[model samples]
Target: MAEAAWGNGELARAVNRTGTETGQRLKYDASAVSHWLSGTSPAAKALPVVLETLARRLKRPITAFEAGFREMPTPVDKSTDTVSGLIDLGSLDMDPSRRGILTAGLYSVALTIPGWPDVVGRFERLRTDPHLRIGMAEVRAVAAMTERISTLVDQFGGRMARPMAASFLVNTIVPYLRANADEDARKAMLSAAADHCYLTGYMAADERHDSLAQRYYLKALELAGHAGDHLMYCTTLRGMSVQAVNLGHGSTALRFAEAASSASPQAGPRMRAFLTGQQAHALAQTGDKAGALLHLRTAEVAMDQAESKAKAGGRYDPSSLAYHVAQVNYELGDREGAIRAIQHSEKVRPMVYRGTRVRHRSMLAEWQIEAGRLEEAVQNWHLALDDYLAIQSGRADDRFRSMLSATRPHRRNPHVRELLERARPMAGGRGSARTAQGAMT
Candidate 1:
């Protein structure tokens, strides 16, 4: 069917041209065309363009599903479904069984990679609905709720807080967004909604629900564009980058981090530092030791500048900077360096950052295990386990699982055996200790 519309070489050029028009730099060739004909899926960003190119040649619309491409649910039209779609997503996220199903959905960083530029381009095209009446009081209320939920997530972890945050979005914020408002009020409301969406997305990621996290982040980005809030857009992109790196897509993560930095060149020092630190971590994951270190240094400089200009406890926190440093060092195989950085993070972390503290302690113990200091590792793990038992967090559970896997070899020892028994019940539906032990190996 593709060959009937154009010669093989011509098809590749046409697809590439279409992609370029959409701000995507695609390099499809004759071989790529042959691969596509044999049922290979094109890059996510290129797929629509490939179809559109074919449609142009055939003088009709060509749908991917008609060409034997895998069937995917039709995406929500950004123009209409932004609010209601978010509400539905929030409702689904709040249901334990439905949340699990959503989490099990497939994830692909490619789908997000090519959309960054397009998001920025759409900002200028946003239109305001004059019928929706809203004011500063309502916007302030949403912002205040967002801040409170963020604090709650920091202290209690996202397991309990995610649902509450989602509920607020569905019950309170969405209605205000849909209410009659002038241009300024509408933009402010949209920005507030975007911030809330980003927070929900972050909490979802903390709980290891990557698929839901991706959807929330995309929705946040769409809201930000409509609100003409470039900073929020950059923040949402950074969140996506963090999730991507956590899932081991370093190259895609780097693209997201870089895009965030590039799209907001006028961002404050603290924002720049955070974005650069994320880039360093992604580069470390990709095995670019020198590049990672260079970015790390750049991030440090940015942090110093931020501190010089403003007091702490604003948008950016110093503890987060240290955590990113620890992550970069760990990825670079610097166990000692990673340990020191995490220790610094622990010292500087605010009291309300309980979940973050637990995660850092867990990481510290893992590094100790790698360093052959089993006694110290055991001590740290005990502290981590106390927090894990108290907090409801899937990420904490994941760390505990990793710890159990690492300690399995020594479980025959009295101390290790006792710890294993203590950890078994906490594994939560991951099955018995024996099952976990077998799965680890």
Candidate 2:
């Protein structure tokens, strides 16, 4: 099974997607995976790989763990009991509270069965347990930690943390839900899976890898459907809409934004506002300044209303507010408005999406430079550069290169050259891992 063993790590690495936070991908020290080759068995959830790996090695479609042959024997009916049902169930609850009941950290990892005894026993002896479950909080923490890591990537450019982030998403978030969660928890797990998908997609987008972003967004949409979180689903749709816009698919962008607005239940003032603004940006790209402006005003008023209300859980984040608006204004040739929007965006300062916002900020600075605000653009780029530097250097793509690739007359401008030059260091800056490692030297 050495060949199979080699393939296991390769497959694990393939799924270890970095542009997203990836903490949970189990890193077994030397020869950990090699254990399976001998007469070793993996407990419950690890079967997905154990089976697939064995199948690959044996040169056949490997089924149940028991069917896995010599060493690893999957328990009877264990796969059915693991997490598939929970993910299905969690997706059904409309009320957030009733929707997905979270398992405490103890049972989250331990309670693989339907009874209380086994779960409690595992919790009581958690320290001695060979396999520790990923607690619900740990799962939930993925959502939070991804946000933080994204910011670091955005602020600095993709960094070493990018791979680390990818690991968490795959190992902790993806597998935990895949392993645990009941029919009820399944629904919630789908939402969580969607979150993982979105983070990966968003980070990929930041790295300028649109194809991967598209794949992740599509997966996020599918997972969101399972979670039954309409808002979240639509939010991801909006994300796809943004990608569409990035790809010069203004019509597609408009479709997604409209869908976001339409799918939204009440079209809450804030959510609607953001969606409308997105549509407006699409319209602006199509030279529909009037239509875009109309949507923009509608969006602003909605934001005003959202501001007046006090609510929580599952709303379109306000982090991209300024960035989106600035794009609209820049396209419309409203220098002051675009500048103001950029200023406003800094105020929202999303704690979650900070991973790769530099490119957005860089765009803002480019506009400022265009508006003859050389000093302001330079000033704006400093912060933008800092953000760019924060991302993993390997992942920091040359977005400006694409701009130059386009036939836009602006690519020839001196300001654009300056901006691209300024972006290089940020884009190439070492990640935290490299920096720390280098510091020790």
Candidate lDDT (C-alpha), each: 0.78, 0.55
Candidate 2 on 147-265: residue-level lDDT in tens?
A: 67655654555434435555565445545554544455546656776776676667656554455455556556656765666766778878878877876767667767776777775
lDDT of 1: 0.78
List model 1 lDDT by residue over 40-88, tens digit each.
Answer: 9998767877776776566444667766677764574756567768778
In model 1, state the lDDT of residue 371.
Answer: 94
What count of clashes does model 1 give? 6
Highest TM-score among the candidates is held by which one?
A: 1
lDDT of 1 at 272: 84
- In candidate 2, residue 59 scores what lDDT? 44
The lDDT leader among the candidates is 1
lDDT of candidate 2 at residue 359, scale 0 to 100: 59
